[model samples]
Target: MALLGGIKEVPANQNSVEADELARFAVNEHNKKENALLEFSKVVKVKEQVVSGTMYHITLEASDGGQKKVYEAKIWVKFAWVLMS
Candidate 1:
C-alpha cells in the first residue's frame, strides 16, 4: 500500500518503449495491494511528428487485484497541436 506515484517518466517519444516502461513501473507498484485505487503511477511522453504534427501521450497504470493485476492505458493529448500552432 502507498508504494506508488514514484515511477519516473521516460524521456522518449510516442513509441512502444515508453509504453513498456510504464507497465513495468505499474507492476512494481502493484505488488502492494493494500492501498486503494486512488493513487497510481503514470508516464507522459511528448513527441513532434512532422507528418502528424505535435502530440502528447499519457499512460496511466493501476492495480486491479486480478490475474492480470497490473494494467496500463494511454491517451493522446489533443491540445498540444493547438498550443504549438
Candidate 2:
C-alpha cells in the first residue's frame, strides 16, 4: 500500500482489502448496537510529518456521532538498500 496524506492507503492485495472492509463493517455494526445516537463514524483527514530519521508524526481527524476528534500516532519505518556483488 502506498502512503498518501498520512492515511495508510488501502492495500492493493485482495485479501487485505477484504479484511479492511470487513473490519470497518464490524465497527459500524458494533457502534449501532452500542449507541443509537451515533449515525456513523469515518475518517475526515490525515497528516504526516517526519520527526527524525524513520520516525514520523501522524495526525488523524475523524467524526463520531457528529462530533469531531483528532488523534495522534507515531510510527517508525525502516528503509534498506541492498548492493549486489
Candidate 3:
C-alpha cells in the first residue's frame, strides 16, 4: 500500500474486501499516534472506481473536556497500495 501520495495502480486480484480491510488497518495505525485524540474512528465513506481504485473518507470523533470534535481523513487504495494526503 502507498502511504503518501501520487497515482498508484490496483492489482487485478485485489477486491473490495481486501481494500476495505487495508483502509481500516491504515486508519487504526494512524489513530495510534501519541497526539491522536480520536476514539472509535471508522470508515464513513468509500468512493471507488473513479480512477481504478477506492477512496476512503474516515471520520474520527473525540471528546475533549466534554466537548466533541470530529475530523476527516482521506485514503486512496489501489491495487496493492494505499495513499494518504
Candidate 4:
C-alpha cells in the first residue's frame, strides 16, 4: 500500500490516449508560460502523490522543431465540492 503523500508509480504507455492527453497538457502549459514551441510526442513515465488533492509527476517526450527531448512536469489537480440543495 502506498501512503497518501508518498509518490507512487503509475502505469503509462507512450501510445495510450490518456498518456497522450496528459503529455499534450504539459506541453501546452509549458508553451503558454515559457513561450515555447514544443510539440507533444508521448509520455515516458508517470507518478502521483496524493495530498488534499493529487499531484501528478509526468515524464514526457516532445519535439522542439527537430529532435525529441524528455521533459518532466508536475501537475496538481484539486477537485471542487458541489453543494446540492
Candidate 5:
C-alpha cells in the first residue's frame, strides 16, 4: 500500500478512532520528551500521505496547563517505528 501519493485529507470526524489514538500518542510522547504536562483532548483534523508506510498529519486540541490549545503533530507510522513531532 506504499504506492506513494500526495498528501490528502482524510475523513475527519469527532469519533475517528485512529486519529484519536494518534493524538493521544503524540501528546504522551511530547510530554515524555519535553517534560511538559499536556492532556490529550481530541482530534480536530487528519491528513495522510503514503510514504514508506504512512505519514499522518494530525491537528488536535489538548489541555496545556489547563488551557485548551490546538496543535499539530506529524507521525510517521511504519508498523515497526513511530516518529512524532
Candidate 6:
C-alpha cells in the first residue's frame, strides 16, 4: 500500500506505527544531540495527491528540559520502488 495523505496529528495516547518507525529512524540518525529529544509529530503533503513520487512534509518536535520546540521537514517518497523491493 502507498502512503496516502500524511498523518495529520500524533495521537495523545500512542504514536502511529508509521510515526514509531520514523521516530526510530530519526533517533538512529539524530539522537546523539545532548540535552534534547527529537520526535516525529506529523506528516503532510506538498501537493494534493500523495502518489508514488510525491514529496511529503514532516513535522517534528524537539523537547528539552520540559519545553518543546517544533520544526518542519520534507522528504520525497517512492512508494512503487519501496513496494517492489
* 10 residues in a row with least lDDT, candidate 2: 38-47
- What's the CA error at residue 37 for candidate 4, in Å? 0.5
Candidate 2 residues 35-79, lDDT tens each?
Answer: 643332333333333333344333334356678655443445455
* Candidate 1 lDDT tens digits, 7-82: 3344555465646554554455545564544344444443222223323233454435422233344333333444
In model 6, where is the ten-residue run with the lowest total lDDT? 40-49
Error of 2 at 40 (Å): 12
Candidate 5 is scored at a TM of 0.83
Better of 2 and 5 by TM-score: 5
Q: CA lDDT of 73 in candidate 6?
A: 50
Best by lDDT: 5
- For residue 38, model 5's alpha carbon misses the true position, in angstroms, by 0.4
Query: lDDT value for candidate 2?
Result: 0.43
Clashes of each: 0, 0, 5, 0, 0, 0
lDDT of 5 by residue, 22-76 (tens): 8899999999999999999888899888888879999999998899999999999
Residue 77 in model 4: lDDT: 75
* Tens digits of lDDT, candidate 3, 1-85: 5545443445534454654565556556666765554344333344333345656554445454456666555666676766889
What's the CA error at residue 7 for candidate 2, in Å? 20
lDDT of 1 at 41: 43
Instruction: Give lDDT for model 5.
Output: 0.88
Consecutive 10-residue window with the lowest summed lDDT within model 5: 1-10
lDDT of each: 0.42, 0.43, 0.52, 0.82, 0.88, 0.48
* Candidate 4: residue pairs that collide: none
Cα error, candidate 5, residue 17 (Å)? 0.6
